[model samples]
Target: TGVASGIAQWENNAFPGDRLDQLDVTNGQVFVQKVDGPVQFFAQLGAYSLPDLGSPYIRSGKATGNFYGAFPQWFVKYAPNDSMSVLAGNLPTLIGAEYTFSFENVNVERGLLWNQENAVNRGVQVNYTTGPLALSFSWNDGFFSNRYSWLWGSATYTINPSNIVAFIGGGSVNTETVSSAVTPLYQNNEQIYNVIYTHTSGPWTLVPYIQYTSVPSDPQLGTAQRASTFGAALLATYALDGGYSVAGRVEYISSTGDANAGAPSLIYGPGSNAWSLTITPTYQKGVFFARGELSYVKATSTTPGFAFGPTGTNTSQTRLLVETGILF
Candidate 1:
């Protein structure tokens, strides 16, 4: 797989080295997997960018080197029976509805709610399927911190051919002070939960999900007060004729805490809230694909010097993105 993209934005949150207009490699990757036998393995090697809403953009080269390295995901699975399997690896996380990479998502840039979730981790996972229900549990490093002190689980049920629901949750078993490009210290120690529903009928697919995350007060962790976030999002896609499709997403998220009490900044800042809307139109044929995205974000109750623009005082931002890629 490969991707190249360009971005144009207003109210750019000029985070020192970031820019208002940029060109970058979105994905340069390959996958290798074997899934037919009792011993199965999957490996993904490449460089990729993690473009996200309300955050500074990191180039693909730096993202690959600073976050998960060149080989982001590789796993070995043992399946002695048809209903159960055990996997050990640098695994994809089960905490959120969105995936880690651009090609795996409906929109080019992730939503505001995704900013509060973990993407990938190093861990062990077990999966089982029975009837219409599927279950997965894992012991992993939360926030890719490599501390190996997090427990995560998910339960999914299929109600019919067109309806499915899932409940997912995860948290750190111990406070981890690790901080890096992939791991934010406060988020690494927080507990997160999600409730998601998916419905598909003919040419339309819809997904709705709600998320909650809480970071407790721990002086040892440099947090003097507890802070939490409540978020909701809806993502939908409509397939049109002649290899065309359109996707849209809307999200709202708010944090709870008093800035005066030394609460950690979660979103724009403590006690801040944000909402976003995104639209993507896509065209794909055979091994090639292209997409264009338009998105807008607005923040309220934000602290000074913590929002958007070069001065970090702007409350709104708009962006346009174009990406062309191939999956071969």
Candidate 2:
């Protein structure tokens, strides 16, 4: 279990318009796991107070308090052999450099790429590992839906003890029909791809990753339009003596095509581009930790600049966050 508290400030009026400068209890979680022979079980239940900074649809409706919300994860795994395993339940998506847990991330807020991608799914996955190569395949509910079906796969290669690379890809299709008509009302398909690389040396670690996704247009709009998004991020961390460390991250994202589509994209609307830089300093001693970060974000649109508020006026913003927590 863990408890974290922090303060955040935004230069311009951002999404969290109500509270621009207020104390927040970012995360409180409980993790339980059991392993016996070839069977394994794990569960994570927590309440998160941080606002959904990037994607509004993710965990947006789960907030019950000013800065408190609940999110849960559970899964079971069975291994029949040393090289193969099967898992079923709610599992974290395996496509991004950052994890769902706050403590596992180098920075306090997720990057543009991480927010655009899917977070978790309920389904079954099979994995196989041999030598320096690992492969996995999964079938799950589409995107964040609980009904539709989607399929995804991943392949990873361990180049050496300190270097590794992975490729993850997935796709899903949805269709609707009316009466006995020969044509369907709408047919939609979505695809996503990601590449991640990690390298570690001594006290320094680096991760560089890229992602692309295509979203289908909505049928209610009565138009066959589509939008696509591309993004990349680089993260680095270095550790110093006496439980001190520093980290930095840089990211870029672009959205093109139909601007009115209901698909998920980066910060701004379609035909928009954004870039950000973040720096963080951290200290850790025993089970206690503290971190401070400063970030700058700038966005440009095809027209009307960037809209961070009720009016499409602001084009850039800066944020500062400081947090401290304990892990026990």
Runs in model 2 deviating more than 4 A are: 1-11, 16-18, 50-71, 175-189, 218-223, 260-266, 302-306
The candidate that achieves the highest TM-score relative to the unseen native structure: 1
Give the alpha carbon lDDT tens digit for every residue of 209-328 in model 2: 998877666674343567777889999999999999999999998887654644433357657888889898999999888998887777887335335543555676677778788877
The candidate scoring highest on lDDT is: 1
Backbone clash pairs for candidate 2 read 49-67
For each candidate in turn, the TM-score is 0.97, 0.85
lDDT of each: 0.90, 0.69
lDDT of 1 by residue, 1-328 (tens): 4444443343355655678888888888888899898999999988889989889889888999999999899999999999999999999989888999988898989999999999889999999999999999999998889799999899999999899999999899898888998999999999999999999999999999999999999987888899999999999999999999999999999999888898999998899999999999999998788889998999999998889887778898888888888878
Query: Which segments of candidate 1 are over 4 A away from where they belong?
Result: 1-13
